[model samples]
Target chain A: MELLGYLGEGFATSLMPINILIVMIGVTAGLFIGAMPGLGSVNGVAIVLPITFIVPPSSAIILLCAIYYGAMYGGAISSILLGIPGASTAVATTFDGRPMAQQGKAGLALIAAAAASFVGGTISVVLFTLFAVPLADVALAFGPAEEFALVLLAFTTFVGLGGDDVLKTIIMICLGLVLSAVGLDLISGDPRLIFFDQPGFYSGISFLVLAIGIYGVGEILYTIETQKSAPQVTPAKITFRELWYGLKEINKLWKTMSFGSFLGFFVGMLPAAGATPAALMSYGIAKLLSKKPETFGKGAIEGVAAPETANNAASTGSLLPMLTLGIPGSPTTALLLGGMVMWGLVPGPMLFIEQPDFVWGLISSLYTANLFAVLVNLALIPLFVWALRMPFTVLCSLVFVLCLVGGFAPSQKLHDVWLIVGFGVVGYVLRKADYPMAPLVLALVLGPLMERSFRQTLIAEQGNMMAFVERPISGTFMAIAALFFVLPMLKHVKRLLRRDLSPAE
Target chain B: MITGARGKLRACLGGKVETIMLTADRVLAAGIMVLSVYFMWHASALPIGWNGMTGGPGGGAFPFWLSGIMFLCAGGIVLRSFKDSAPFAKDDTPFFDPDTLRSVVVVTLALTATVAALPFAGAYIAIPMFLLWYLKIYGKHGWVLTGALTICTPVFLFFFFEVTLKILLPKGWTEPWFFPLYARFF
Candidate 1:
């Protein structure tokens, strides 16, 4: 098949000596980066991106993708050992992984995490390989109206499906969209919301600035507020026998594993629904399906396996949209898209056809990276556990320093540092108030793209509002978006009606 | 009613409760609502819709529409904030205890000072000053730990970011001091 040929060529490219070495270094670096407190895939990629500039596009992408996979897998190690999620996606892992560590089964916990991550990542890569080109071909047919509708659908799902507080989530998302609108229009060079005629206002607020601000500094501040010292860590080594023991136990939990992989991949494929929600969704479903539902969050191996597997799958799944449709499903992918752009390669429908080598090489290399990550984690479990031995004070300070460095790295502007500090405070306050940051950040990332598409759609249709729901693909997406709004209101109304009809108890 | 949600927000200047006011959520929501109005107002200053030139929208059209949505959402948040009783939304719960308030102020001020100093004192000097103040003054650690970290942090940053990655980190007046190191590395 054509797919086989492409993959064979991809292998030839990925298996080159320099590319393999880069993958090894990228994965190793990502592990250490993810093992650190408050450093996720976004931070890992953003910090190391400059180094990859010297390489060719395929190699650069391979290195960044390898880092992404490594960070996604490494996220579980911190959760298992130190009861801290190194990444937001790994938050669910802390529930059972930490408990497993507390119960003196740290070795088993690490292996479970590594094995589950490998399985999820590997399966998702297979899915990506089979489906990406076909999906891109479908996307290539989409016009501005359809693209606008699709992004609109993504927005509703983000707020509607992802958050607990609908009103607050709505407000947060609207705020992000508005904030993103505060610069010169893309088509028209006229400034929209430039406050003081400063040159800095010409260019919009970058996602890199926002991401480092919210996730990096904000996370550090939040960690400091609810500071718990790491539990006494005895160095637990993962032997081959223990690794087999863990995998054998995980073998019985195939149902949960499957649920996590499928759910994560599906959610990950969505632009709005990312790894955090995927992990949470799978964990919730696992508990619902379990005979011993009460065993969840109490050192359930299924609990550790499900979320660890899911976040990785979701992380992988998020890439599909970016590669196929030019929409970065997650922040990590957004950064990767930036990396791709820096290498003079645009990520979109045309990318699959034009730059077959880079796309296929990245995809095929992910397979190698996933396997490498498993081997690396399995071999270096003891070393990762040693990272957990760091004191909270040292961890907290170092994280703040890294945030400062990472914030300043991209632009080398003090403005970004100020933004990081400002948003750090805002993020901390928002988190404390129980407002979700996911919807806000997602909106910010997609906001400009949505605006550009909307304006273009309006222009193309000559200001006809109905065109959004006229085109077949756009119409379908808009109708689904309408359902997202309607279903919630219908539920609220039904509850109100039920209350009115019921007699007093 | 006694679940600590439905109560007046009484501020304590020293130790005595002052006049009661709005809950934290309501106050925050109201603040955001005001901000939304401001953004919406400025956004509307541009041509609000189609410019009738080449079938293109005015620069402000998208922002104007989005800002309108934000304004409405902010209003909704303001109304809902009063009724919400989630942890940080409570009327009675103090925003910060005295000690925590002190720590927050100190840390925030320190971070701000560091950022402000970056263009003046540069990353090398500013970072160490921040770290020293944070670790020793705020964190109250031993001099040895504080001193060691302060000295080593910049060296590590220099080697990693400058020597290895080739990123020209901002160096202010003391940029001259970095020139020697830059020559060594670059």
Candidate 2:
């Protein structure tokens, strides 16, 4: 009965004309950003965050959340239309999506993606409303030592999870940690990386600058290098029959959808493990388990269904952790968390007790936003498809303008513009070198929090390294980290030894 | 043996060119590393005092640790670059692909110029101009698209920052001139 009451209140709050308009705008902008190669939800949210600072916290958060979900859905369009995956999570969608496009089934593929996204997103939001409070209660028990260990675990897991060159990933992570240090030290009042004694450096590297440079400008530079005369696209029109066809395809992949939604929810609960990895993992698992695994890369409907479902589900799932606990599951959610804090709405165990109205309002609004996104996408697909038909030169140039304005809008500073350009060059070089950029970004987002925890632990223990070992929660986390390190090596060594003993015989 | 000697000679010439590229990249990376260290040192040298806070650490503490870590990583990069035997690898693709290199350099230079001019020109003017050049010259876009972009971009700026959010953007030289016009509408 209480939940129902909250839900009704939430609906009332979300239905406000201004909130509805903001959601609409956010979804529209998010779609554009996400459709562009290299610009993901993080970049999209970061670009818009500065504007939000001036608005009411509730409106700002609603807009940001709308954008987050919008980007997750928009990523599918590019994967289906262009061979390039717009976001990392969309990489799996491309396996089938691109093939579908090649086969002139682009319209159907998009319809399937959008429908699955809506279903998955709606279901995950329901789960979030139920699970968020309990999770927050669990998080409230964590002390500094335990928090520090958890951060360490997150950092290490992210670094090792790259599955590429570990050295490069570690280097990127360390670089991010360094970049995070550029602003004034939070524990001490000292400036840590000020070059010209400017107050700008005191605030440190702006997330806007980092995001625009690495994702937006970096993408432009990359596209410039690989500039090609794109094949002319004839916009594929979807009829009522085709829509029904897409619906049938969704029904056929029900098992994949369910599995993906569950996986996404689980992954989304973890801090920083959001849509991208969940989508990728689900797609990979689906491919591995499929009866016709060989058909996966050749327009297998499951390929599109699984990732599309998982990424959307993960978006909602991530909100669970952020809303319940103060901790965000991804950078976008982190920014949203920042917004909530700025609004004077304290998250964590107290939120449900103190701010039930705000909590319920946000939750109910998500349902409204999801419905709005579906209607918007359905009506606008043709127009967006027309946008895809626009020449690359024009499209790329427009993106460049958005990047600059978006980058500058946050701080109204010139230094951020320079940062964007510099990071663009750095990102380009990293891309050329096959070094992954995601870990670097993840590190940048997590670095400051991790450092705060570390310093707090040291200060509390008077620089005693044994503080972590003494705390049971921290000890368990450390033990888990130790296991993470050992298990991989052990597996590798076992494989090598087995090969040495049994191979060739 | 004579053929092998000829191959070695060719290899030496190729390796020399590779060495030069590698040396340049290494020097650039090293310079950046040194700059980073200097920044870290400078940041650590500030007179900000730490007030003891229970949950939130003081401002300087986090930066100190992060900068220190960055400094270490930068040092590692420099060291690794020096230790590596091969610095560059020649492209297997065609060497004289002007479009590839030209587009990259042009876009990069354009972005750099935009950044340099932002403080003086302001975002409203500089961004539109950049878009115009990028679209009209490099992109070979139609006038309709270019004009639409140029006009709409500032309007977007107006709505997003000035009107909706109430955050102020840089007015630069045009602020006084356009102030009346913008203030009237905004």
Against the true structure, what is each candidate's TM-score? 0.90, 0.85
Displacement of the residue B158 alpha carbon in candidate 1, Å: 3.0
Model 2 CA lDDT for position A399: 64
Highest-DockQ candidate: 1
Q: Give the per-residue lDDT of model 1 (tens digit) for A430-458.
A: 76666777667667767877888888888
Model 2 over residues A216-239: C-alpha lDDT tens digits? 778667776765667545366778
Alpha carbon lDDT at B185, candidate 2: 66
lDDT tens per residue, model 1, B48-90:
7678775767877676776677667656665554443333443
How many residue pairs clash in all the candidates, one count each?
0, 15
Q: Is model 2 an incorrect, acceptable, medium or high docking prediction?
A: acceptable
| Model 1 alpha-carbon drift over 4 Å, by segment | A37-39, A42-60, A228-230, A287-297, A342-344, B1-22, B83-101, B140-148, B163-166, B182-186
Prediction 1 TM-score vs. true = 0.90
